[model samples]
Target: MTMIAVCALWGMLFSVLLAEPVQAADLIRALMFQEAQRVLITSGRGLVRQFPDGAEQVMTTPVVVTQLDGGMTLNGARAASDMVKVRGRDDDLIITVAETPVSDQPQDRLSDKVSDAAGSAVPPAELGPPPMGALRGPAPLHTLVLAGAVQVIRRGKSLMVINEVDLEEYVKGVVPSEMSSGWHLEALKAQAVAARTYALYQRMMNAGRDYDVVAGVQDQVYRGRRGVDERVQQAVEATRGVVLMHQNAPVFAAFSSTAAGPTEDAINVWSKDLPYLKGVECPFDANSPYYRWRAELSLQDLENNLRRQGIAVGTIASVTPFSFSRAGRVGRLRILHSEGELILRGTDFRRVVGYTAVRSTQFEVQSVGRTIVLAGRGSGHAVGLCQWGAKELAELGYSFAVILTYYFPGTEFNNTRFGAQAPSSTP
Candidate 1:
């Protein structure tokens, strides 16, 4: 049969999963409005509060928000003058300079009335990052581009600026950051669903915490309304509330750039062997740039890595692969030294040897004098969906649902429940 016929066949395997249906379009507002559907994204340093008039605020007396040499840091005033950093006793956010409060609240002064009647709801057109793209001056002077509103709070001594936004809106920002918008629509849809699921999982995990998820690599990259493509927005809306589930719980839905040969089991990377995260072949990923790679590290550099991992043995002697995972990745390895030997899991070794340099756990180690060579396949922990593989599949005429099931087997799809507050377990 043709690829389209095969896609249709695969699609038939998944019918509506729930007897009581829930619309994907309204899933966020219906199930998670109580939870606020707000993802707490960590704002980077030097986040200028850009107003409708183009005014910027980088600091507030005691609150010194600077790049700090291109790092995320917000401490007391720097050496701009004679201001000293003061540590407050209580754990609330305070914009204070030395001892006095320095409040720089955003000004909301609109000449026109927001509504025809007081206490009436603001129309849908009026809801967005306040006057960001709105024309300000007489000359149609400057169009202000910005992320959504930022909520600044203190996490201990430092101020944490969070971008609190609706969960579906948050997915639109993530799809572009995680996958290129120029790729196939199905692949973008897969990314959207995965990101949405991951966000909900994080929400459930951090429900009572200060933030649900961060806007960094640690969670998912989110830049509010900035850089999001229209195609990306369409993909997010298409998937809507759909999420991967295993035993009625929202699967962690881990994903990576490429899986050179086959995806890995969760136990290999995170040490958690969930039901849905089993090894699966991904032959299409050979089209990825990271399909095959090699890294050469000096023996001394390897020794430095050992020391950084708190292992001391002077110099290295030999390296050996102790064990392998089911997906053909190194599960355990031995580092022989002149004094003794150190045992390490493949993921831990990759961390110590430099994640970028080592690239992946699937590699062969060979020593050529003072240099140690590592030849590997793939980039990132090959756990769930292989993005490049998905793109290739989509290009080959597979639907998003078919693509998702190909990567993650045994998970059913339905707009109902949509994986929010997923039942503790489902078969």
Candidate 2:
């Protein structure tokens, strides 16, 4: 390939890998060949369509979704003879099985709001259990054919589904989903711990909801069995039940593919003053493609993007960096529109303009003609662990514990099981 073509491919892969967290939701099936071992997960979510595949042979079957509470209320059990497809309609949900529709709308039609073991909303830094509790999964030691037994449920007008798999199996899928399997074993082990911690954290945050985490980057990408890698599986197994703990609770454990330089404190990114999420020098990820990169967008596209996100910044005349974080990432940006000047946080601007376009907060902004250029370093929200840095350290013989400690200070490994939480403690 030509130099330009090779460069383009490199950039594309960098962007895809650095896409970081993808909080997506979907499904294909859920077949149970063994007895369930009480691991429950909300199987699907949001404007989703499900059909019988494999041996079902175009046949439709009624789905049974029951609340695990005493008397085990069957939340959604279709009539034995109907196959239903759920749809989100304006502020309500609709289940369509046959030609006619069964309006199984709750009288309240309220959204699924939840809290933790305590009745209060868990702090952003901590995970809270769902009000409805967790759903049991199929057979403890068996691999679930998630494509079967797939069903849909309603949370107001939002329809959601989830894959109910064993907690350990779910962690296995996360190992490869969050990071490449080819990295050093120590780095992969660190990722496993982070993934497991975050998975359970999401579960708590989404308690009483249909599913804990999505299948995309939003919560940490998970591919079920398909995404699992043998090396990644070993990493997950090695670190089984091992979690990073701070004051007896799982830390937020935010991570990025690369930290161009020193990691940034979580407070700078999310306003969460986490003790362990403090920024530290990381000269290890210099090898990341995103360690240095550039992107440019025409003035017209910039203004159009703002409008698309409902930001009325009339015609864009100029864009300026309003502020910078301690990590050198843009903390705030000023937009000079024809109507007036507006200020927006760097993070929000990244979301509106396109995350991959901005890449990282550490960047220089310049303009040439009618186009704006952002030459930046690093990728992802600069907080918590740095994946590339971990890999580099591991290459130099650093174990997972050492790698995790280097990124997240004041944290210690705590061996525990699923859904476990300890009392809060200060480092």
* Best model number under TM-score: 1
Report the Cα lDDT for candidate 1: 0.57
- Per-residue CA lDDT of candidate 2, range 305-372, in tens? 88888988788888889988887778899988889999988877776776556667788889998998
**Predicted candidate 1 versus true structure: per-residue lDDT over 1-427, tens digit per residue:** 9999975653453223322222443222111111111112223333333343455554323334432332324452242321112222221222211110011111111001111112121221233222211222221111112233444433333334444556677787667656777788988898888888777667656756656775544455554554577888889878876777655556677877767877898877877877777878788767776678899988788888778778786678888799999988999999888888888888888767755566678999888988878888887778888787787887877777777766677775544433222111111
Off by over 4 Å in 1: 1-149, 416-427
Positional deviation of residue 20's Cα in model 1 after best superposition, in angstroms: 7.7
After superposing candidate 2 on the true structure, give the runs of residues whose Cα lies further than 4 Å from its correct spot. Answer: 1-151, 156-159, 416-427
Clashing pairs in 1: 62-97, 247-425, 247-426, 248-426
Ten contiguous residues with the weakest lDDT in model 2: 105-114
Q: Give each model's clash number.
A: 4, 40
